[model samples]
Target: MTESLRISSIDLAQFSESRDRRPTERIPLTTIIPRAWIGFSQAPWRFVGLTALMLITVTGLSLISKDLQQGEGWWQSALSDVLFVATIPTTLLPIVALLHLADQLLPSIQSTAQNEPVQERQRLRWIFRQTTSLVLLEGVILIGGLNMIRIIGALIARQSGVISTVVLLAGGLVLILWTLSQTLALPLLVHHGHRPLAAMEHSRRLVQNNRLKVLALLGLLIGVNLIGLMGAFIGLLLSIPFSALLLMASCRTQTPWVKDSRRNMLPT
Candidate 1:
């Protein structure tokens, strides 16, 4: 019994030491953004092509919608709505490509950390399978949340005007927080093979003490993409991948996966 107790105590100490050695440092936006640009440059042509396609589809849809608005028929509105729904899946295509790019880039980043080359090839079939589920899950979550918020807003609006304003503000705040919490979900899913709910939980935990940094990174990506729009939307081809790499870098730096690798290297 005494020997068992001693071994348990020693194990606890080792566990504590391992936890202490894990990096809690956040990657700076400056580092991540620049590296993201480098990653975009190195990305495969397929990713770039997909991004371009999405941009073209969106632009074409916008033009069509504008033309439809100039017409005066009940069918015009119905057609516009149909076009809008069709565009939703197109938007997910770029996102799917981004996630695959991030997953491919992660091993290189990890290899750099370990000072060793990690050769891993991305399977196109796997990427497609994973991306389909992820896109569907995200679509459901976003659509469901927006609908709930809309319903709540409507119900509040039926009450006092001032109260309705407060409710709307609160709802918006909640939505923002929820978004921030899930910022790392896609990366977690892609890199760690976590399920939808698990990935979201992991993301929430990872962002717990680093919400501000995450929000700053998100803002930086948005600003960069907006700037890209200045170049006739052609810049989005670069910005979209760049932002994805930045997000992946952020996730890689914060996750405990690297520390786990280090622990595995230690004498057991």
Candidate 2:
């Protein structure tokens, strides 16, 4: 099926919940990266264009914030602080949007077939609801946990420098693991119609059995983004899409919704 038609026809609620709960096979990076590359290759400019737009907005706000901070006025500093805070959402919104787009676009590029039809308006509404709810839920949990860790670290710092350092390191490690475990939550929600908390729970479970592979995938994506950072952030235009595509692809492989007979034939 054509990409647009396939995307439009997807019924998010039709996913097999039983299969979703089952353990996903570990997809080799060898298969994932090339498939992601091909997916991106098929439609580079749209993804790149979206990233470029985000980059511009983020960069512009950051520069404006810096300038405001340097200005000789109290209100200027306050406004700069607001702008600085705005940058976080500015950065996150694009990423969430990109992931939504990648989720829709990737399956067709990968030649996965689904047969359901929904209107464009309905799809947009579904995506918006899912994305917003997931963002709010995930953001609160992660931020709350990190803040608690920070508070604990601060308390420890008063007791002993070395011990505080150790505590902070351990806490950071815990947060990293927690973050990794929820990596698939967005894909789960957008692709499979999972509720926010349910998606997070499922993602945690999925990551638990495949911790090492998930870690490797994260490391690879991080390295790619880091490389992109070195190029004056222009590389993010490509790297961001590549990362999103790979992530969506990995999620699909791990929690496929196809029939039993076709499971073995899926591109892993």
Q: Which consecutive 10 residues in model 1 have the weakest lDDT in total? A: 259-268
Residues 109-208 of candidate 1: C-alpha lDDT, one tens digit per residue: 4432222333223343454566567667777877788788778878878877788777778877887787778888877676676767787877887787
Per-residue lDDT of 1-268 in model 2, one digit per residue for the tens?
6987777556443455555666455544556776676667667888998898889989999999999999999999999999998987777767766776776666333332243445544664666677778888878978998898888888988988888888888988988888888988887676666888888987897788678878888898899899888876787788888888888777654334545623523343
**How many times do residue backbones clash in model 2?**
1
For candidate 2, the per-residue lDDT at 88 reads 73
Predicted structure 2, TM vs. truth: 0.73
C-alpha lDDT of residue 64 in model 1: 89
| Per-model tally of clashing residue pairs | 0, 1
Q: Which parts of model 2 have CA positions greater than 4 angstroms off?
A: 1-25, 107-118, 150-170, 254-268
In order of appearance, the predictions have TM-scores of: 0.67, 0.73
